[model samples]
Target: MNKQLIFFFLFVLFIIYSFSVYFSGTTYDKGISHFTTEAKLGKKLFQEKNCISCHQIYGLGGYMGPELTNIISYRDNDESIARAFLKGGTAKMPNFQLNDEEIDALISYLKYIDKAGNYPPKAYEITPYGTVNEIVTDEK
Candidate 1:
């Protein structure tokens, strides 16, 4: 009887856990699919150029370049700063010799990505349960 009761309790806990997990929803942005025409072109260009080899987004790409996830916001939303870099290139960065239209498209894509999220999250707490909880705010 005790074994049966324990099994029944475990079954109830499993059902509750499954329901909670199903209703929690996803943390990803739903608007990610809605990119502008220019941004879409930029995404294609980004893949074609293999920019991930030198740069990272959300800390998932190469470490040779700085993470670009929040670069637009970090640069005070100055598209010109990024434009100049792409136009002339830096000492560490090679000049891709991209035309004006290509550069603009890339900038637009970066702007769209910037709106997605931040890297190295602003605030996070490490729980005693060995889980990290991100504290989201409306600062942006």
Candidate 2:
């Protein structure tokens, strides 16, 4: 393998690792916590910045990227998206420079939306097989 290709691959790996750490750091349940103030501010930024211009959530905005309603589950963190937004990608893509707080606020707003929207209750049980039951249901 060529040295140039090896260097390029390593560089890409570094970028990936950096993004993963940054984004994961920002994700947390913060259950029942209210980011209303931040969300409100973020909403204004969302509209003003025309994020919906290309992205959608719960059936609104342009049809470019995936819906952002549950975007946190999609990307590792805001840093990844922010980096993508600022660094630019393909020809059609554009860069938007926003500081850390702005990105955090946006993420907070998105998390608020996702929580309000509700998800299926989680259930867990021990299982052994499909054709045979490890434990039969109790009957009275």
Top-TM-score candidate index = 1
Candidate 2's TM-score reads 0.50
Q: Model 1, 103: alpha-carbon shift in Å?
A: 0.7
- The Cα error of candidate 2 at residue 30, in Å, is 14
TM-score of each: 0.66, 0.50
List runs of model 1 lying over 4 Å from the truth.
Answer: 1-34, 124-140
Clashes of 2: 1
Model 2: per-residue lDDT, tens digit, 6-73? 99999999999999999997885444364588877777788888888888766677888657765654
Scored by Cα lDDT, where does model 2 land?
0.64
Candidate lDDT (C-alpha), each = 0.84, 0.64
lDDT of 2 at 126: 61
Please give the TM-score that candidate 1 achieves against the real structure. 0.66
